[model samples]
Target chain A: MTEPPFRRVVVIGAGLMGTSVALALRRFGVEVLLEDADPGNLRVAVSLGAGVPVTPGDAPRAEQADLVVVGVPPAALGTVIADALARFPSAVVTDLGSVKAAALADTRAHAPAGAGLDRYVGGHPMAGSEQSGPLAARADLFDGRAWAVTPHADSRPDAVAAVERLARTCGALPVQLSPGEHDEAVALVSHLPQVASTVVAGLLTTAAEGHLVLAGQGLRDVTRIAGGDPDLWTQILSANAEPVARLLHEAADNLHRVAHTLEKRDAAEAGLADLRNSLERGATGVRRLPGKHGAQPEAFSAVPVLLPDQPGELARLFADVGAAGVNIEDVRIDHSPNTPAGLVELWVHQDTVPALLEALAHHGWDVHG
Target chain B: MTEPPFRRVVVIGAGLMGTSVALALRRFGVEVLLEDADPGNLRVAVSLGAGVPVTPGDAPRAEQADLVVVGVPPAALGTVIADALARFPSAVVTDLGSVKAAALADTRAHAPAGAGLDRYVGGHPMAGSEQSGPLAARADLFDGRAWAVTPHADSRPDAVAAVERLARTCGALPVQLSPGEHDEAVALVSHLPQVASTVVAGLLTTAAEGHLVLAGQGLRDVTRIAGGDPDLWTQILSANAEPVARLLHEAADNLHRVAHTLEKRDAAEAGLADLRNSLERGATGVRRLPGKHGAQPEAFSAVPVLLPDQPGELARLFADVGAAGVNIEDVRIDHSPNTPAGLVELWVHQDTVPALLEALAHHGWDVHG
Candidate 1:
């Protein structure tokens, strides 16, 4: 096999991210020493074949590790990172934390003077689920996802390289940025949306049950991220307080402006133009996002098909589409309760539509449009 | 095959919703005469087999239509409904519009004295796409979706029944509500989320290009609806101003509160609890949404499997799973550009997981978790 990214690595937490990292590294034949404060998490990760549990007797192995990864909770990131830097003096130390600059500041405040602070870097794999803990961890959790590597001014070049290498070894693309820039970027892309979704979902709590029965896919998509762990998000938002709070204020102001516009729209039709302009800006902003693998979203067209609510229908559908040699760029299934049939939207490059349609028709599949 | 729900139907606007209704009606062998101010849209809908074009010679057919469905832009709903009531004097009139109360009020104000106002009802199929116009029309657009059949105080019981029959005939569940209650319900479920998504997406206008490259699925989901037609949304929001504005202000207050809590978090750790509580409320609200078929979301377990980025792999995977006699409730494919592989998450009932796992392993499919 190819040489491992590192000879030996020590992971300080055995939670979802930690265990997943360990499992990914193990795939590359790296020797990983796993440790967690909770014995239960450690045992679960070990049973999953993520890594061998680190014993007190493995002090030398810990010290000799070429890389040390601290994958703890947001509240504990700095302390664990500092501890790892000091413990594995010869190794590069990195962390998995959402907020970068705060973790760096905390590390600087906690690390002992003359310790290898230059060997530290920060990382956040832009991939996770609503579910948490070791049982939810998977070796491919980071596959084809963005892994941000945020390096501070004093971070050593070799240390930054080591973190990037770790990202690649885990099947992720490392996007490099400074800690401050990383914080600002995530504030716009992650934290602000989190709060917006949270506020929208929080309002749903007051809605009558009969009203919520009218809920559709749009509301579900808008609120899905709001279902994330409260304590964890609280820690993350707190760590990135300044930037996130600024965006939240901006968003709130925009919402209030919309409300005022709607309120005035009846008296003057011109206010409708202002409302339309605001929505137009949102449409333009949505267009700015890089589509899958950086392609433009227009590169694909979605063909929705109606599928019978049965075991083998989807299998047959896929088999027919495959026989046509059409590659499905993506698939989205919309199934509501008590519906005898579900809608599956197959996204493919526009150029392949005719082939897909022919194959679908040949197989007697119900193409919606 | 079976008797049509109505002997004859006239659709007044051949846009997305209107044409979709016409197409759905055509499936039941109903005689449909479609009209549109835009010749291009009318031609396209007619070419797609949605319905026959209404020529000047077809005036008698339209006047004789048993049902008149006004599927126009939000701003035109009122005038058209009033006009349809006058034109098809003996026919029951219904409309496909998002907001209900304003449409009813508009029709009431515009209808000629002694006209058939009692024959009017309002309907909204709670299913749509960001894309618009006749080219996007589909016969199954409202299949298995909630179609709110809202009636004003003056609406005849037979009129309400006719509208609900239209909904059922289009393969949708007809939900009954008063016009005012429908507005309030949509304000919470649809309008609120639309503005929240728009406001959040609106902020992305000022984001740096590099920052936008870091965007992930969470941001995408949160902003998807913001890509909808601004003119249409502006009209929808304005027509339902009171309730939407109220909800907007509530959401804004929540956002401001979260921002304040975050700002005070560094000064006092107690502020973190407030933040956590806010997030917890969001999580609880999300849980209140009825899952597939109105079931709880937890009824299905998601099994994520890695897929190679090549034709036929998905077919092989689905074929393998189907051979195991397992029913797939839903499928979500997450594929990023430049990635050599994708992740397909198959949501199945919990009891079928073992058989799925066994089939996956036997077929050499890579299961993520």
Candidate 2:
């Protein structure tokens, strides 16, 4: 096997991201030392074979570490990162935080004068779950995900390279951006949608039980991310307050425009064109999202098949598709409890539709248009 | 095996909903006559075995129909329903439209004096897809879904029963509500989310391409519904203008409040509590949605297992899962192209988790928490 990216790495927080990083580094045969304020978290990380706990007696080992990954909560990111730099004077420092600018500013504020400020870079792996903590960590969590590596102006080239290497070692593609640019990008892609989803879901609290019972897949998808931990989100939002607030205000303005146009539509039916334009713009925007693994979504065609509700039906269907030598890009099962037949939509490359259709026909699977 | 609900049914406008309804009725040996202003849609529906095309030569069959289902665009619902009542005076007329109050009011205005207005009822099926037209239709589209039956004050009991029966014949649960109440309910559950999603996605048009590369599943889910046809949505929103505008205003106010709180947090950290409260409310509201087929979402647990990226691996996994005798409630596959292993999240009843874990371990599948 190739030599490990880092000779010795010390991870200062044994939470989800930190533990996952340690576990990923261990896969490369790199020596890892883990530490956390909470003994339970440290114990769990160690037991998961992520790394050996950096006990008091392991101080010398930590001092000799070449890289220190600080994976604390947003509120504590800067202070902990600054402390890591002071404790391990020669090691390059990095953090896993959602918001980059705030963390960089805080680190600069907390670091003593003449400290190695050039050693720090900010990284955010664009991957996570609604769940948190050590048990939720996985070595492959970042696979094929974009990891934003944000470097400050004062950051050294070698430190930025080390952070990029760290992202790659975790099975992620590293995209380099300045701290401010990274913050601005996430404000649009991540924070804006998060707040918009929250506001939509927040309105659901007033919905009658009968009304909510009418909710379908659309509402569920739009609000799924709203169920994230409130405490965590509060910290995240607070840390990136300026940019997120700007986007929220802009969104509010658009929503108000729609509402005003709708009210006018009720009065004279004059704003139908405006409503259509807004909806059209939305349609155009949604089509711009990159599909799984960076492919265009339209490049795949869905062939929905009706599967009988019985054991091994899905297995049999998949087996037939596999026999046809067609790769399934995605599968969506519309399972309805009241019916004996479920619709499964198999998405494959547009070119593979003919072969897949033949396979379904040969297997006697009912295919829907 | 049993008598079909309606002896002869006429479906006008062979679009997605109409074609799906005809296909569903055909499953029960019911005779259906399909009609559409567009010859292509009628031909496709007829060729799918949904029904026989109602050409000019089939006037006798159309007149003898016991039920008339108007499945035209929202703008034409009232005129078509009135025309159907005039053409087949004895037939009970119902419509598949998103907004109930507007359709009922328009029909009331268009019907001639003493035109048997009691035979008309408005229906809004709480199921749809982003795709439209006959080709996207499916026989089981409404399986285990709610179908709202809205009866105005003048409707007769038999007519109401006929509409409810229609709902059942299409494999949906019939929900009874007044025209006004159904409008209000859907304004909250459907139209509100649609507009919210549209607004969020509309902003994406202004985002930088690099920023969009940072998008993840959350943005995708929140914007998926925004991809629905703009013309169709314009009509749906226009018809439900009053209720939808009211809810949109409320949502806009809430978004503005959150934005203000976030802005305040940046200055003094004073409104963090307010922000948290909003997020908390959103979390609580999202949890209120009923799971698949009305089951509580919390009743299921997700078991994520890593599968090797190879053809037939999915079939093998499903076969193993079937051998364990646990019914998989849902399956979500996170297939990253760059990875050698993909993660499949199988949702099952919480009580079956231990059994599933045992089966997975025995099969040497790598399970992730």
Residue pairs with colliding backbones in model 1 are A292-B337, A293-B337, A336-B293, A337-B292, A337-B293, A338-B293
* Candidate number achieving the greatest lDDT relative to the actual structure: 1
TM-score, cand. 2: 0.82
For candidate 2, the TM-score of chain A alone versus the native chain A is: 0.82
lDDT of the candidates, in the order given: 0.86, 0.86
**Model 2 lDDT tens row, A1-369:** 788899999998998899999989989999999889986567556756788877789898889999999999999999999999999999999999999999999999999987899999899999877667776778899987889999998999999999999999999989998888888888888888888888889988898758777777889889988988898899998888888888888888888899899888856545888899999999988988776634666789999887664433555677789999999887654435653345668999999999999999998999975
Candidate 2: the clashing residue pairs are none
Q: How do the residues A326-369 of candidate 1 rate in per-residue lDDT, one tens digit apiece? A: 99887655445553345678899989999999998888888895
- Looking at model 2 chain B, report the run of 10 residues with the lowest lDDT sum: B333-342
Any runs in candidate 1 off by more than 4 Å, and if so which?
Answer: A292-369, B293-369
Q: After TM-score superposition, what is the CA distance of residue A304 in candidate 2 from its true location, in Å?
A: 19
> DockQ values for all predictions?
0.32, 0.32
Q: Highest TM-score: which candidate?
A: 1
